[model samples]
Target: MDRANIIHDLLDWIETHLDQPLLLDNVAAKSGYSKWHLQRMFRSTTGHALGSYIRERRLSQAAQALRSTPRSILDIALQFHFDSQPSFSRAFKKQFGKTPAVYRRTPAQGMTEASPQSSAQQPNYHNESPNLHLLYNGKCTDGKCTQWMGQR
Candidate 1:
């Protein structure tokens, strides 16, 4: 398999495993690459660091849960594997520019994209948006280069 395929597969795997522990060491082991190599390859292909991508995806999924469920903020935070409600709140606020409670109270339409800007060469990602199709900026013979996450 090529580097592109590896990255696409990894993205799908990451999405499906978001609720679990997804530390970089574990992800590197799963990818059969050294941490250094994997980081370099992932950053080169996706224009985002592997760790940052995982974090943003988790935050995005948490945002979806917040909008669609009546679950408590702590529950949502813990569900997404955050260390604690306060940590979750800090990351959430950093990603979405609002507290989870405020975000839940606001209408979805009132929300704006608060994700970090993609690099000049890659497609953009919305850090707290729901139902994103994460595309690998590469050439693929098959249409397996995109991974959809946070789908309702």
Candidate 2:
């Protein structure tokens, strides 16, 4: 019915099937919006494009796999659908400023917080994260404020 609903529906599908192929048209169709309209809505409301959102989400999952599993960098990269190590490495470096090796060796250290400003949130956002709780317990009571769920 609205931009938030559109984005929420898209993200719900994303979370459930991160490993599956995603198409903008499919997402748009699911949300009952045109592809272009959904793209514009995502950019206007979230300030990041859908492609970037999917990439970030994939990277976040890759980082999590690196930390939680004994998998190698290549394995993690492949797990997130990245075709090659260099491509994955470049993206990982660009977003996180570290390679998979360094990140896996120490996930909590050398970590940078996603400023309330940037589109990047911490990559460790599995179900148990406090952020998930925030999403569940918080709401925009006024419907106009852009504040986060728990923030005042």
lDDT of 2 by residue, 1-152 (tens): 55565565566577656666667777778778788987887677544577766776677677777776787888778777787999999888776667878767864754433211123432122221213211211111222213323322
Model 1 C-alpha lDDT per residue in residues 1-152, reported as the tens digit of each score: 88878987787588779889998999999999999999998887666678988988889878888887899999999998999999999988887778999998988675553433355654334454343334333333343334323332
Deviation (Å) of 118 in candidate 1? 22
On lDDT, the leading prediction is 1
RMSD of 1: 7.4
Question: Which residue runs of candidate 2 sit more than 4 Å off their true CA positions?
Answer: 110-152
Candidate 1 stretches greater than 4 Å from native: 110-126, 129-152
Most accurate candidate by TM-score: 1
lDDT by candidate, in order shown? 0.74, 0.59
The TM-score between candidate 1 and the true structure equals 0.76
